[model samples]
Target chain A: MHRNPSRPLSPHLTIWKWGPHMLVSILHRVTGVGVGIAGAAALVWWLLAASEGATAYATFLEWATWEWALLIWIPLSWGLIQHTLSGLRHMVMDIGAGYELSTNKTWANITVVASVLLTVLLWLYIFYGRG
Target chain B: MSMEIPLGRVRGLGAAGEGAEHWWQERLTSIAAFLLLVWLAVSLLRLPGLDHRTVASWLADPFAAVPMLLFVGVAFWHLKLGLQVVVEDYVHDDGSKLFWILLINFASILGAAFALFAVLKIAFAGSAE
Candidate 1:
């Protein structure tokens, strides 16, 4: 009810010193938006193509298996992993467990590293194990 | 003198009473997405091939189809909530913020519907053509 027109807008990103926490926060948003658009589109396409019949499915496979598609798929997978991990970290914080500065930084770093590792492991499994 | 009535002040006890529900839903959906994604990753990894018949048959299983639908729905809902926060935070103009939020909601619904429809079609019609 009390509107303060002069209230400073939050999270002036430029003014704040960069840290692991900031990186994680920014990437969380970036990957979130990225996956929401590109990832969701890919998912819908895959489902629709699969349901449509063989020809559509074959066409989708062609695109999905293309060398160029890996470029998108890899990053998309990474984004998915990173965003999920970060979301978990956020949930933990929401439960009031990780407010300590050191704990927060540690989790942020862990999220980044683990996402990359998991993404690589996924690709490795797809290429080698599946074959 | 302050013009607000005592009842009005007590009615809304905190900053936007709606925040807790939004916050809780985001967390709940995130947890659901976390589990569903693990299932998805492992399932996709184990798939012998990506051919239409193979993938369709895999999706045709009740275990796969049900969870896939749930994943699509929860993931899109979670996505919409997350993006809404981003838009609310960054987009300065009220008109643009509202537009982006509505667009996000609509797009998420469409995406989820398309996904569920596709899954249901495969589940019921059987991928054979």
Candidate 2:
């Protein structure tokens, strides 16, 4: 038994030509796991810290706002946004709408862009509008 | 023409017929989560800051605390359901998939319980802090 020398195997990521809808579809799962798991941990920590004492709350805030923490914080926020938007897109499709190739791709594109834009605007409101 | 046997014609859908329940729960929770999550983002931004007093007093209110608890409960529930599928789809080994699913269930419950406890504590005794 022999396989073709140059043939790509089943379910290989590199074998497929990528599309916007595929990116959004994959992002839906990626964001769901990332935000649901890691973000919940952070939120729970925040809650616990707040429940304990002012000193504990301060400690949590200090790290949460630390410059390096932005790496995790930003992505967590973005993932939450993307997951929400993509879930909405999926909901539309789930209801037996948006299945046409063009409609599906269009909504996928919108989900990607809106998620990013909304995340940015959220931060902007936090930093600038609040001030 | 239907590909239905006599028994199949009598019973509709999957063998267990509960797959749709999982799917329906996911979507139901998603709708709730979407609304609650948006509310959370907006409420957080409304606060002057994330200082202990500001945040604690915010959570101290029934209005704030209730939604947060719902968010925690709904979110963890949704994640458990969603992650179960993820593990099933990806983890080919039966033992491994089962292990992951069990962990997800236990961890989600623990996480939601912890958050709920914290929120409750704040609501009851936040001012004392």
Candidate 3:
């Protein structure tokens, strides 16, 4: 693959014009990494805390609900939703449908918008509906 | 070295027959993870409280415990597959790329194991006596 030393890299990101598809593609990777690293760590912590007892669980709850932690948790939740939606889109594309230019663009837009909307609704339910 | 044929050159390097299997497995796990996450969100919402005992007991239910364990396994597997791609794309160095791939695999396995153990502990230990 690297036989030609002078050939530019396949994905010359800076040279290619950006579009909705590109945005979604990039977000997919970003969110995947985010969930892989921080999200996984958070899950492990939550599990350990839960198993440890009431005191540990309470401590985790307090810290997780704190304002500062919300910064990370909110974005992580959004990323999780966004990645899931985008994954669904890719799954559809994998099956050889939605290849038309307009349809692809439309799906890309839907993936982003729907992800944000769903995330907001989830948080709303958590805060208000649960209470 | 002897000259290689054009078809052989086109075939290129890396694991040849395994790409399709890896791709299918990744997709399968993604689908499973998506459904499991939805179940988790709904379960969390229905919980009477987020306190230790309530959450632990909820997890202890066989219905919840089994799926949660499956979720951890599938989700971490998906994570490894996704991160492997990212590392391969951005990390141009061969050694660094291999290292990152191994690290991602190990981390995913360890993280998933820890989560599974915690859930099982709660399911059997009865949550802090």
Give the candidate number with the greatest TM-score: 3
Give the lDDT of residue B24 in candidate 1.
76
Report the C-alpha lDDT of model 1 over A1-131, residue by residue, as the tens digit: 77687998676966878889989999999999999889999999999999888999899999999999899999999999999899889888878899899999999999999999999998888778765
Selected candidate, larger TM-score, 1 vs 3: 3
Cα error, candidate 2, residue B20 (Å): 1.6
Candidate 3, residue A120: the lDDT equals 92
Each model's lDDT comes to 0.88, 0.88, 0.87
Across B9-84, the per-residue lDDT of candidate 1 in tens digits comes to 5663432234556767888898898899899988886788778888899888899999999999998998888888
Model 2 C-alpha RMSD to native: 5.3
DockQ, ranked from best to worst: 3, 2, 1
Q: TM-score per candidate, in order? A: 0.87, 0.88, 0.88
Over 4 Å off in model 3, which ranges?
A1-15, B1-18
Better of 1 and 3 by lDDT: 1
What tens-digit string does per-residue lDDT give for candidate 3 at A31-116? 99998899989999999999888889889999998989979988999999899999999999999998899999999999999989
Candidate 3 residue pairs that clash: none
TM-score ranking from best candidate downward: 3, 2, 1
Give the CA lDDT, 0 to 100, for residue B59 in model 1: 85
Pairs that clash in candidate 1: none
- Runs of candidate 2 exceeding 4 Å displacement: A1-16, B1-18
For every candidate, what share of the true interface contacts is present?
A: 0.88, 0.84, 0.98
